[model samples]
Target: MNKNLRVPVGIFGIFLIIAITLTYTLNNLFYLVNFLYIGSILSIGIYLFVINNKYGRHLVQFTIGLYMVIFLGIILQENMQLSGFFYYLFLGVFQAAVIHYAIAKIFGPVLFGRGWCGYACWTGMVLDILPFKTPKNHERVKNLGLLRYMIFILIFIGVLILFYLNVPNLDYLMFIIFILGNLIYYAVGIVSAYILKDNRAFCKYFCPITTFLKPASYFSLLRVKNTSEKCIKCNKCINNCPMDVDMLDNRRKRKNGTECILCLECISNCPTKSLKI
Candidate 1:
């Protein structure tokens, strides 16, 4: 939320305002609405790279807000065909796109990492704003983390099997299943986080996005690093991590956790400036 970033952020906001207004006021040329929407999405994506300030996080939030509004518009379309229904997938894809870009700048770790997750994701947003207590630990189920890859394997196999079986409209079914999968996956993550007292336990184990994104994030240009020289071993970073990553342990071991989201909560909160990047 640095003051310097405000101007660009404000400009981006204004662009979105204009786009929405055009869609509503210029109904005669509604096709332009999609272009306007894409423009806004691109603006928000670039805003992340423009402003290193944490306030850019809200760009992600606002994008989702815009997406949901447009999603309802699409869903409300008259005579909407199944093809039209598929556009709903854009909601998730757009979020992924934002993260994909953000990670690219930060040197890449998907699943929205700490930057996009803390800022843009509706599910993560809800969890962050919730008036409740939650734990951040994976020690109990750390071994189970491998299950996500297996889940991915099963999903891939299922898609391949359906294709081999000559399933009609398999693409449509796959799209539907993908949409359902995101909803169910996030729902399960949120509910499980509530029950298990861990905010990202399910993300660490069950989320296919995390499964795929984690590796991609590993190869990403940007990554979280520990500046252990200043660490006082306060353990705040570890305790505050939504993904249950033990930053202190990583620092101690001279390693970075693969699950690190680069959320910067650790860096911002670190009294010693020991946790950074």
Candidate 2:
């Protein structure tokens, strides 16, 4: 294979494996179709990025984002939210929203880091369109990251209570909660973006899903690395990083290292291309 084709080909092959394996195991043709579509979209996005299209990342985000949000969440009523995860988990069912959480936000982080946030997150698609793509120091207030834990605990507790109460029409309730949850997420995301002057304020400060993503991503096979030789210490990478990741620090345990969304903004901003993802 041509070197330029390596990334896309690898991604396509991986998704093919996933598609085949899941379809065979689950005896569901939908798995094959679903994975094929997502794979193709991601492969195209990767190719565009290799060719240096300015909107390559955005293309993937919007394509996968809108499909997951509208088709799965709204039309199919799949409930692809944190609450949905808890709801499904409590039911001991491995299908639907639980599978999505396992593959995208949980174990998937170990392989691709927070690539979902950059490429396919419906919430991020909306948040990234805000004015503040790059966050300033003042916008990142201290201790705000702790809020995600609070949100996580609250979601878990809320779901547990509902289950304990033997709530009827639980599927209907989940569908409603999914809609309401997304609305609250968007409202909070937009408000936080404006107030913090950072487009990713909601992601950095209060996304409950991060509780799963961060720890796994710490051991991720793919992550941005910084080399100081050609860096010039210009601070361009830090300035443009939406996640406030210290790309200048090469260690995997660097401050906010687990927060990297693999958005490549820092790499794009580097004068000497010292940053590699």
Candidate 3:
């Protein structure tokens, strides 16, 4: 029962106010330069900047703020389709060959410590909107953390099989699956955060992107680690960590956990300020 959530309720309230206001204002003016879309971006940007006041230093907030900036950029650009950006490059049917070649055949991690989760994941943004306090029962499901790799392989294989067969409606199928998957994921995330008191079980036990990022993130420069002899085992670091990593445990083992997202929440919220880069 951690019972301490850094994210405040007023944050969501602000988002709602802005969203509703923009919806009515921009939707009504939809004919005027497509202000609806632009207004939505502005509304979200204002909300994030305003909400940052509550959890300005938290890692989750930092990650979310970074993503909002990128998303706003894309929405404003008008040439870049957000769905295409995600599907074509990062997590679409076409990406299988690139992922397999880089991660499997070449035997290299994809990035470094799943930094993508912190930066580009739209699903993570959805969860970041919810306010929940306390860590959940992430004790240990199994030692074969490699299960996620197996899942990725299977998904890649399915994509390849369908590709070689020249299956009709493939793009449409992928689009449908993508939309449904996101809906289910965010639905689950919101429900879990509300009822189960944990915001990140989706990241822990389920996210396919997390699996992709795992191999890539080992080589990333942006990562999380405890400083030299600074932590006092106050558990603030662990408590504040959205990813449920036992920072104290990492300190004891002289390693950063594989799931670390480098969001600065732990460091900022630590009472002794022992949590650091």
| Tens digits of lDDT, candidate 3, 218-253 | 554445566658667777777677777776653423
Better of 1 and 2 by TM-score: 2
Q: Candidate 1: list runs displaced more than 4 Å.
A: 1-59, 65-123, 126-142, 248-256
Residue by residue across 171-226, what tens digits does model 2's lDDT show? 89989999999999999999999998889999999899999999999999999988
**Candidate that scores best on TM-score:** 2
Candidate 1 residue 92 Cα shift, in angstroms, is 21
Ranking by lDDT: 2, 1, 3
- Candidate 1 per-residue lDDT, tens place, 1-277, comes to 8764564465456545655665566453442454355445545554564455555455555665345323522343221111222332332333223322333323334432434444444455545543333364436564676787787677656655665687787646655664565567668777877777776656566754454455465554445566578777887766665565666654422233556655556666677878655
For all candidates, what are the clash counts? Answer: 9, 0, 16
List of clashing residue pairs for candidate 1: 106-222, 107-220, 107-221, 107-222, 108-220, 109-217, 114-261, 224-277, 225-277
TM-score for each model: 0.60, 0.97, 0.57
Candidate 3 lDDT (Cα, whole model)?
A: 0.50
Candidate 3 or 1, higher lDDT: 1
